[model samples]
Target chain A: MAAGDSGEDKLIARLFGSVATHPGALGLKDDAALLAVPPGHELVLTKDALVAGVHFFPDDPPASIARKAMRVNLSDLAAKGADPLGVLLAFAIPPDMDAAALEAFAGGIGADATLYGAPLLGGDTVRTPGPFTVSITALGAVPTGQMVRRATARPGEAIVVSGTIGDSALGLALRLDPARSGFAGLDSASLDHLRDRYLHPRPRLALARPLRGRASAAMDVSDGLVGDLRKLLSASGVAGTIEASRVPFSAAARAAIAAEPALLETALTGGDDYEILAVMPDHEVSAFSTFATAAGIGVSVIGHTHEGEGLSVRDGDGAELTLARGSFSHF
Target chain B: MAAGDSGEDKLIARLFGSVATHPGALGLKDDAALLAVPPGHELVLTKDALVAGVHFFPDDPPASIARKAMRVNLSDLAAKGADPLGVLLAFAIPPDMDAAALEAFAGGIGADATLYGAPLLGGDTVRTPGPFTVSITALGAVPTGQMVRRATARPGEAIVVSGTIGDSALGLALRLDPARSGFAGLDSASLDHLRDRYLHPRPRLALARPLRGRASAAMDVSDGLVGDLRKLLSASGVAGTIEASRVPFSAAARAAIAAEPALLETALTGGDDYEILAVMPDHEVSAFSTFATAAGIGVSVIGHTHEGEGLSVRDGDGAELTLARGSFSHF
Candidate 1:
C-alpha cells in the first residue's frame, strides 16, 4: 500500500534525491551505484551507526543527528588519511517520526555531504518499530599503499593528537545534568562552547595529508584519550605514557576540572573526542605541528611509544595515575 | 559505561574479528579498510537494512535473519551483474538482547559472508533502546561499464524472470495467518517449503555472467514482479504486458492458489521474490534459457516490452486484470 505512494520512492525524490550528484548514483533509481575507482588510488571504507537514546538524546534535532552520523564516519576516513569520495546511508526510522523530522534529517545530511565534497551516492530507508537509527558507510580514496594505519607505529615514536580533547565529554555532562547551570564558575559563553563541542564534532580532515606522510600509526579518538591510546598501542604492539597535564583541553574543560577534581578522570576517559591520535617520529613532529598550525588547528605531543603494550597516564610529577574506567563501550 | 567491557572491543574480537580474512579488512584492527579495486573493474555498491518486526519476525532464528539480510543485498548485486567483494555490517541491539543472541547474530552473519565469498570487512556495533536492526553495505565489482542497467531496455524486447515469483509472498501469508495450519490439503512439507522460500532468498549470482552480455535492462524483483516490472519499464521509458499464465509459480504456491484462486494477485504482486527480472531481445531468450538451465536454475519469459509506459497483465481468456495493491512497502 505504501509502496505506490508514501514509501521509499516519494521519500527519496522529495528529500534526499537531490544529493545523489555523482554519475554513479544513477539518480538513485538503479539497484546499485557504479563507482569508478580513481586511477592509482585505493578506496577506504568505514561504517558508523548512530542510535537514538544511546548515541544522542532522542529529542536532539534531526539535522544535528544527521550531521553527527556523517561526521563520525568522516572522522574515521580522516584518521586513515584518505580523501572522501562519497557515502551510502542506511536509515531506520521510528514509526512515530514525522515527515518534518525526516526532511530535516535528510537536509542536514545533504548539507554536510555537500560541504565536505562527498555527495550521497545511494542509501536504504526502512521502518523500525523503535528508535531512529542512522548508519553510514563512507568511501574515500588514498594513493595505493599510502593509507595511514594503526599497528604500524614503532617503539620510540612520539604520540601526537590533533586539536583539544575532553570538550565533548564535559559538554555531554552538562547536557545530561538536571541542574545544568550550577557549574562552579564557568561563564555562559564557556557553557555554550562546551555544549556546541558535544553537539558538533570537528573532524580533522586537513590533517590527512600531513599525517599520511609523517605518522606511523593513526586512529580517531572516539573513545577517551587514555582508552583510545591504549587501543592504538595494543594494535601496534607498543606501550605509551601520557602526561595528563600535557593532554590539551579546552578552557571550558579546564574550568570544569578545576571545579570538580574528579572530572579530570572523566576528561581522560570520556569518549566522543573525535580528534586524531597519531604516532610519528620525534623529528617529524615539528613539521607536522607547523602544518597543522597553518591549517588553523592545534597539535600536541602527549607522550611517546614504548616497547611494551597498554597506555600509562602520568601526572606532572611523573606519578602514574589509575583510571576507574578505561574507555566508552556500548555493550 | 558499556564501552570498556561488554561493548564493541570484546564483541568484535570474540565474534567477528576472525571473519576479516581479506587483506583489505586489515583483520578489523584499523579504523577503516583499504580496498584495492582490481584494475579494469568498477565497483558496485548497495545498501540494505532489515529491522526486526518489519523485515522479519523478531523471534526468527538469528541465522535465517542473517542469511536473509545478506541475500537481499546479494540479489541487488546479482541483478547489476556484479561480483560481490565484501560487506560491512552495522547492528543495533536492544538492551534486552542477551550475549547469546549477540553471539548467534555475529556467528550467523560471519557464516553467510564466508558462504558468499563476501568476507566481513568491518562493522560498527551499537546499543539501541528498541528492536534489533541490521544494516549492510555490499560492494561488488564489474568490468568497466558493463553493469546491467534498468534504463537500457528497448521496445520489442522479451521480459524474463528467474525462479518462482510469489512463493515468498505466499509464505508470508501462511506466516501471518492465525489459522496457518488450516490450509486445505496442504501438507507439512509443502508448508515448510513455502516458509523456507520466505526465509531464504536464492540470489541469482550465476545469472550475472549470462545477463551481462544479453540483458538490455535488468533489476532484482524486490517489490514484487508487477511493481518492480513497472519500475523497470518506467526507467526504460517503455511498457510491457505479462501473460498471467506464463508467470512462474512453485508447486506449493500453485497448490495454495488452487485452494484460493483470489490469491493469484498476491502471487503476482506481494513482493519479496528476490528473483532477477531482465529485458532482452526475443532472439536472446532461448540461449539465455539454455544457459540458465545448464546452471540449474529456471528461466521464464513471462512478458514483452513495448514503446509505451506501465505494465499490463492479461488473464487466461485474454482479459486484462488490475492488481489492487502492487507491492509491499514500509512507511
Candidate 2:
C-alpha cells in the first residue's frame, strides 16, 4: 500500500493513536473531529508553523522540535487568556526523517498535549520533499467576550512580562556558535541553562485566568521583547518606555551579558522568547504579581505605557539604546 | 524590518486583511481569533496540508493550489455534515515564490474563504528554504451529537458517491506525461476537463443538510473511489461490493477510458476526486439522491455494503476484478 493509502493510516495509528484520547477524535478514523463549546464560552484559535532550518536546526532533537511546534501556538492561547481545548497537527515529513525520529516527535506532541490538557483532536500528515515542517492549530476556550486583546491597552498602564526574558535568544546565540568566546567565562551549568531555554519554551498558561481578569492587553513575546512590546503598543495606539535595566533576565543570561556587554542587544532584539507580555492598570500590577508568585511564575514590570506612539528604551543613565533590528523575520 | 516582524505584518495586512471580516477576528491584528459556536452546535475540525512537488506540481497556478488547499478541508466538513465556520492557514513561503505569485495565492485563498463562508480567521506565515507549503485547519458546525460518521454504515446501507470519480487521477496522468499516447484520442475539451478536475475540486457542501439527515456513514472520496469505499466499510466494520460498470463517470472520463481501456482501472483507483462518498439505509437512498439533485449536484449509487471483512468489485459479467493498487498515498 502507498503511504498515503494504508501506509498513512498505519503511520498515524501507530505514531499518534495514543494521543487521540478525546472521545470526539474518533480514534483518528473520522474525516473530522467534534468539539463542543461550553454554553458560555467562545473558542480561541491560533496557528503557528515551524520549519526546519528556519525555525530550528534541521538536526535538532525530534522531541524538541515537536514540543516547540506545539508550545509556540499554546503560548498564543495562553497570551489570549484561553485554556487549551485541543490541538490539530499538520506534519510534513521530509525524506530524511526516519521512523525513529517520527516516533520521538509524536511522543513529544502527545506528552505536551496530555500535560497541557489539550488532547489531540485530529490532524493530517503528508510527505514533503522540502524540510520537515509542523504546523499546529491549537483551539482554546475563554468565557464569552473575555479574551484579552493586544489592542485594549491604555496610557498609564504598566507593561509586565512573565518569567525571565532574553534567555531563549541568548541560548539560541550559544547554540548557533558553540565555540564563541562571548560566554567563555560561564560555567557548564549556565551553558546548559541557556541551551535548555532555547530548546524548550515555558508557555505562561498558568497565568491565563489572572490575565483575563486583570490585563488591559496581552501578547506572547516570541519576536523579542522589544519588538513585541512595540507591536503591542502600536496595536493599542500607545507608546512605551522600557527601562532596559529593569528587563528581567535569568542568572545565566545575566552572566553571559556580563561577560559580553553587547550580547544584551542580541537578547533584547532576538526572537523565540515565548513569555507573556501584558499591559495592566498600574494599581493592578501588585495584585497580578502576587498571583503570579503564588503560581510559581515570575512577573516583572519592565515598562509602562504612555499616551503616544512608538517605543523607546532607556539605559540606567537615561541614554537611548538603538537596535539594528527589532525581531527575527523569516522572510 | 525582518519579514517576520514588520514585513510580515505589512504583507498580511495588504494581502488578507479584507478577508478578516468576522468581528471576532480582531481585524487580523490579534494573536488569536475568537469564534462563538451556536448554542446547540458542536464544532467540527479538520486539517489538511499541501506541499509543493508533493501534493501539487511546483509550477501549478497559485490560485488553484490555494483553492485546492482550502477545498480539501472543506470537503471533510461536508462529509461530516457540518457547515463551515472559519479556517486558519499556516503558510511557509519558499525563496523562489515571488511577490506576484504570493498575491495570486492570497487572492485565491481570500476568494474561496469568502465564497464558502469560511472566512480567514487567523494564520501564521513564515519563510522556508524548501517548497511552498500550505496547511489549513477548517472549523465547521453541526447540531450537537448529530455529526455523520464513517463508522456507522450497516450491511443494508447503499454506498453513494457525489460527482464523478477517476477524472482527477487521469488528469494527473495526462499532466505527468503530456505527450503520452494513451490519451491521444481525447479531444481538447476532454483533456481540459480531466485537467481541471485534477486541479480543482468541487466540495459537496450543499449536501450537508441532507447527508446529516440521511447518511449512516460518510466521507469524501479524495483517494480512489474503490479504496475510499473500502476505508468507509472497514471503519463501519462491514464489507462492500462495488459494481464497476455502475460507477458514475463523466463524458470526458468515459471517452478517455474508451480510448484506453486500461484507463478504467486508473479511473477506478486514482485519487483527488473530492466527492462525498456516503452510505445510507437502502430506503433513504432515494430521498437523499433527490435532495442532492435538487441541490444541482450528482449523486450515484455505486455499490452496497455487505456482512464481510473486505471489499470486492464485480464487472459487468458479475466476475470479480482485482485491482493492483487502491488509492494515491502521499508517503
Candidate 2, which segments miss by more than 4 Å at Cα? A1-9, B1-9
lDDT of 2 at B121: 91
CA lDDT, candidate 2, residue B228: 84
What does the lDDT come to for candidate 2?
Answer: 0.87
lDDT by residue (A182-259, candidate 1, tens digit) is: 355898888998888887888888898888878999999998888888888887899998899999998888988888
In the order shown, the candidates' DockQ scores are 0.88, 0.91
Model 1, position B225, has a per-residue lDDT of: 90
Candidate-wise lDDT, in order: 0.86, 0.87
TM-score of 2: 0.97
- Residue lDDT tens for model 1, B1-331: 0124655547756677776778888887789988888899999999999999989888988878888999999999999999889998888878688777767777788887888888888878787888989998999999998999988889899999998988988888888882643346788888898899989998888888889889999999988899899888998999999999999998888888888887788789887899999999999999989988997899999989998888899998888997898766632
